[model samples]
Target: MMSGRGTEAVADAVRRAFVNGMGEPVAVSTRRLSPAEADQLLPPGSEGLTVVVPEDDVLGALLPGITVTGAVVVADETGARLFFTSVPVGGQHELVAAGIRAATAELAAEVSRLRTEAAVVDALHSVGRQLTAQLDIDRIVQDATDAATKATGAAFGAFFYNLVDELGESYTLYTLSGVAREAFAGFPMPRNTDVFAPTFDGQGTVRSGDITADPRFGRNEPYHGMPAGHLPVRSYLAVSVVSPTSGDVLGGFFFGHPGTGRFTERHEYVAEGIAGYAAIALDNARLFDRERHLVGQLSRSMLPVVPEIPGLDIVTRYLPAATGSKIGGDWFDVIRLRSGGTAFVIGDVVGHGVTAATVMGQVRTAIRSYAQLELPPADLLREVSELAGALFDPSFVTCFYAVHEPDGHTLTYGNAGHLPAVLVRPDGAIEEIGEALSQPLGVGSKFAERQTVFEPGTDLLLYTDGLVESRTRDLTLGIRWLLSGLPALREAPDVGAACDELITGLTGGRHDDDIALIHVRHRAGT
Candidate 1:
């Protein structure tokens, strides 16, 4: 009658009958099956209990084990019912018949009992389906525990788990059911002390008919807090909650009722399956949290604080891509020039994560190293282009470098496949330093790069593409927005302050892409 949910129903019925018989002599139950199902379970007198009416001629031919001692036949077309007192015979016939009758009835009842169980399983399935559809763990456990208690007729059902600290040596009590008692969630079960401890310890499984009856489960001094044999208690069962990777005993399951002989092996199997799923859910959540922490750590390590220069102001900020996974390729640097000036540089490597950020660091460090020995903006960028191509992928990076000098107007700068930085002037003028033409670094360009001296207090801004290039907008518009913001930035007290103002003005609230900005100011008179 139970179309699905496997053969648990029939097996459970046999177990229930045995438990019932312990209280009374002849507790009987029947499980019905289709002709096909009956063949699989009963299998034609395999248990030697198939009864059939034959012509009285064949009664004596059935072997003395099945012969009738006395009979009065009432015959019909379908069959015959004869009044007969089976003669006493040996070979444990009394015990065998009683066992067969109990087994057969239990199997017969299973067909119906399973039909009811099938309904409950179907309901549980529906709950699982709903919870899984939304991918919500708390809701899934909540619905599953409630549905299971109602379906199995348990006096109470609750969930228990362990919150392991990273050290792997300590754990706190954790649970997820709607139990009213504080002890339900506050009580910590030791990984080595529960009925499930042996299972977790040996990586095996365990079930108890009564907690007080089993040596492994009953005599545990640690379980004194549990009311297993107390006035309100009866039987209990538990399954090992374990780690999928380490097989560590995270915790155990607990189920009990006031009825004697309430827990059985089949119940143990069901609880184990539920606990296994809960373990997987808890594992997934833990992994998610760990990954987030790692990403944050890596991102911070990728951009240490900018090095301090004796007299020149050097400031750099790296904002990782907001919408992307927690890593990006934006980078910047300030190098003190041998000629008593400083090189303000900004560029972006074209990717994200450890790889992109790594390449960005190399490029940033390489620029500073080469800057210490060069002065002409165009020449320094050329050295960078050739060295980068030699050391990295030919198409790896886009960059811009600007060298600032004492003359308010004598600034030297060039671009190699980098966005021309936004220039904010002392008069509140905003303009992108126009690069007439230059190939992006690593792309090999022959068009000679150029440099120009400009006005005093010129704040140059640099950044990666994540700033202006949303899926809906053009990249050039982002550049132009930075260009427009320059007028306000120019009025800021210093280069460091202007960079902050420019970022807020351009990104609205947050920049989706990595944003690296550097500002350079000129002293009016030497």
Candidate 2:
């Protein structure tokens, strides 16, 4: 009995009832205790009659050597301090005490079950988001494998997928989680056996609590069950990933555990959901890869091969953007004029992808056609700009065109909203010749042409904006860095080595945008 302000009558009635029911002498005692102290007498999930006999001096003074059995804890509005102890054996008190403990244990188990369900739901939501956010096939597959293996409580998991090469040859690849790749290096690719056929054919999910005991486990040839060095597996689960759009089987997720009866219905449901997400992600990645391949090929075919002109050393480099597979509009060309001179051209078209690359091709062809007319730099740009305004949107392209005369001394160039070309004189003097700057093609009516006399051993560099613009450095600072580094090119063994060194030093070999570089060195003895 718990000591409270007005529970004495209730305690006395309960004591009398217990004594009459048991037909034995019973003595009841009351004590005031906090909730924490009372919990120790009857803890959560405690099942059945928990009897504590009295051996202390205080309780023994009232009834010497009393067998204090039939202990019960009752919780009410006040707290859980209503404790009762009887001195009888086998009666109504024992039945009542046992009922309360049994109910508490059941309630505790229910709460734990609900918490586990909520956690699994949350984890599945996170996994779905992670799978849908990626477009890389390798990354998406690996992430899906790792997440599903953790959710299913598997000792190790593997995702076996199919890939088609450029020559249309199909091959199988696998990603592993929770185990080293060397663990399965000696094993051959899984065949469509009795156990694996259902998963690979996308029939349905297969889950076995004890896979070794399953009838479909030992029907394959060569290795009837598992190979000698294979990891021990008693529980197995597998799900096939099928594309939602094409209905094609993309891959299968296989999970295993060394302990028996490790997976459940809930594990099967979660694995199926993960397989759905992986299928969609893999489909998107494969489509993206194909499109990128075609666009890259088209962009590369439009670039020209630098001609080997006598008395002039020319080297050019074109690098696609490093971030994505989208093609850019940066291009460079070296045209040998019929009059024994050389024409150098570099340009950039706005935007990216197929549209930008198409515009670049048109602009490059227009410039080459106008250059063959023997027009001055200004006249050639004017003709190209007029054609751009009629064919494309306003200010869509920026270009720089320079023509070196037959004497290999006079250089005439036109700048149409392009970066200034750097000229390195024989004396190591640097000069930026951008006096003919004008609006980009399709925006300006008149173009300006600038003329300069190049002495022997002079070096000229023309490049697109990608070389002097980046996320970390502005155009001005990048240009300054380029100017400061140009003097070192004088010591380079050849023009090709010098061009490679310049690009590597400026972008640190990891640039995000496309780069088109042209290095023209007037021979020292010419």
Candidate 3:
């Protein structure tokens, strides 16, 4: 006699059997009930298998008997058995009964296998999603560690990134999970050994039930044991994150468990899939870094180094955006004009990266060429604007150009869709010059020139919009902040120190857009 739950369990087992064996859905019932009771409990068109009395009229001999309705009855010394299947057949009854029994046994094993495979697939998909969600290398490694540990049912997991220093020597950064930071604090990073070599070198996957038992485990000299507080590990599985395009190994995923044979072949496959996703993430990060490096180099090369001018102390600074922000097109130059004046220019090309940098280079060259003609500020602005429009077609630029005359004690400057240049007076009063601006260059916009008395013992400051523009603050507020902070900056010993202090005050030393600043202090005596 079986309880109600036991009967349902048997029914589920038989249904699985029917589907796996016959490729069809069939109802099965097992309970301790007579024919009349089973008919009452079972639904119409469903089959019921129940225990029955051998003395019942349907089976006089108390041996196994098959009914026309696909019900089979068998009598053993302990009790009578009944099996109900959907289809009724006219084959050898004993052979059919034997086949059904065999299928039920096979169903149990197949179901277990299917469940394991499904788990592996789900784990792979989960890790893939995590890996693709972001490109930060540290976060990617941490996520990989978590996913690998969970997928393999390991006690601990770690990811190691192979990195090269500026000196071209190789080192690694590690992200760990299922372990204490304190445990690793006192321990040295693991080196390449017989056990870790396969994955580290990209030779193949390594799955070991007991790493210490392997004969070649510690072939390297001085086989120091694991750290004292390190978690015990008997099972080990490692997979290498290898770039498919370059075939270079970027990193490795390593898992460990205290119990031997904790990881299986299925776990290895799941780890492999995780490694593939991580490899892609690493490749993307590398490409982004490479592009930023190249753009930084190009933009820096285009900026003119400050030249020593008589009676003028000039200082310049260029700050690129923080990581993850696009490289911008801000530039500054200090050129000795053919008229024996110092030309100070700051401009921002209206985009980012290689294209913006290229356009900026062209405009700077045009401005320098026009300045060499010793034209007045307004005429120079007009010529450079026209040149930028013709050369950089759709891209526009905002510029402020000024030339300081040493003998005349006057500053001649012009603006084209740019921020105002700030002049700090000797009395700590601030004035904004070049306020009358026109449209930016590359649009054939008109420009105007303005002259102001650049009094002795005063300072001049010119910068791109990046120094005064942010999402939360308008240009007006940024300018106000700069003006309010000028009194304190006027006492700085030199233009270089003043520029550094001004940047720190205005931008807090970090900017979303690139910043270019040119500062000049005029003295009464050279």
Candidate 4:
């Protein structure tokens, strides 16, 4: 393909040369091709021949001594060549050709340098985005290793790092790219050898065109250099990943190729850039893991263990959200009241993370404190709501409080913007209780208590929104699903099994929100 201002003239010149050389008639067609189109067809540094005429005439006008008419520039994979359309009479062409070739070579070298720099910058940006999106340390290192291997044209790459467990014990871990884990399964962790120590110790980057020739090679005991059954490596590069915040070496990236002199200075630069990104990503993941662990411990510590009450069976379950920090505000408690009644409580504060969990703990404690006063369910909820409004700002909470009287035949309850409770009778009839429904706590809505005769052999199920609400199912549909499964609870061996069955059916064993469940059953002979 040909492109430029004088493509038609060049096509004519080519046809004339072809006819004069071959002495035969040949057909030649010309079409306009944009410079952009030509560049697409033939990318930079591509192999092939290209010829063009100088588009600028100011150069010739500035040089008065040489009256240049037309000049053509020819380029190939090797380098570029310049030729004049007409030679001066008795002029030696050899010297001029040599000078033009030297100038073209220098220009080509500069263009190649710029292209390499541009490519490295683009690769670093892409690797940074991939690393930042991952919160898992293993994934971050594997991705960084893969990107560095490709950028450096290495046959294999590995990232070796350190991790600390809960007991404060440090251990080593490694991730490999372009090779399977089995390849290194039989080998022990790399030692602090003369050649490998610099990278692991964070002294400086080590790059070798032929590592075996280095003075540090073969200086260690037991096999001297690479161990037996190791992948061949003549070209090697290593860079330490140092944490920017702590100024400690997190890990090191190593790349290798079997061919001699496969790596260059540019490859070392690219590997270092990827190592920097990997360090930041790994640090963020470690911080997230620590926070998640602390939040989980706090949430578990706040849940109350049910006490053994005569003639009553109580079973409870609490599951945190599946994503993010994996902790939230959902909580459950079974409080033995002063009047010999039992208060079953479940509440969910809005949002998640450490803040939501702390709020939940405070609300749960307040409810337990008020239960000691022997107050009714409605009065108890009113007191908690007033406390919640004063303590929690711009955050709301949903709760349900129910009291089963000492006689085991009277049930009083109050709901504050929470899901309605489900009751299954002895004969398998289902009833949904929502008469005491009101706005959530901190919303300035009054609570009205409701009462029902708690018959023997009856089961009451109370749960947070997570049990029946998800991205795929709305509250209305979720409630319908819950009601459909209630009649079957009677067939369950015990209340605990019934709670598990209901959760499995509604959430399919996977839920995105925090769940709190309280199942209570009154025995027939009580």
Question: What TM-score fits each model?
Answer: 0.55, 0.79, 0.73, 0.79
Displacement of residue 360 (Cα, Å) in model 1 is 3.3
* Weakest ten-residue segment in model 4 by summed lDDT: 86-95
Best by lDDT: 2
Ranking by lDDT: 2, 4, 3, 1
What's the lDDT for all of these models?
0.57, 0.80, 0.74, 0.78
Q: How accurate is candidate 1 locally (lDDT)?
A: 0.57
**Preferred candidate (lDDT higher): 1 or 3:** 3
The TM-score measured for candidate 3 stands at 0.73
Over 1-526, each residue of candidate 4 has an lDDT whose tens digit, in order, gives: 3444343343344333322123443332232333443343333654334444443353354334665434444445444433443222222222333444454456656777787788789879889988978898878988998899888899999999999999999999999888888988999998889988999999999999899999999999898988999999999999999998998999899998988899888888889989999999999998888877887777778779799988888888988765567578898899987778998888899888768878888989999999888888788888988998888876779888889996748889999888888888888888989634888887745898899878889988889889899988998899899888877777778757777888988998768898899888888889
lDDT of 1 by residue, 1-526 (tens): 3232323343332323322223432222232333443333232433222322224444454324654533222221222222233443232323333454566666656665787668656654565455344334455456556644453456676555555455666544434332455545445544455555664464665555566556665445755545443334457655666767777665555566666687765566566655555556556656654654576667678664565554334557666654445567777777766677767788888776777767777877778778887746667667777777777764468788877665445567777777777666666666677454577666754435556665555556666676667666688887777666666565656656677666666676556777777765543332
Candidate 2 vs. true structure, TM-score = 0.79
lDDT score, residue 376, model 2? 88
Better of 3 and 4 by lDDT: 4
User: In terms of TM-score, how similar is model 1 to the real structure?
Assistant: 0.55
Number of backbone-clashing residue pairs for each candidate, in the order shown: 13, 1, 0, 0
lDDT of 3 by residue, 349-431 (tens): 98887688788888888888888888887888888877776766688788888888877888988888888899988887788
Error of 4 at 496 (Å): 4.3
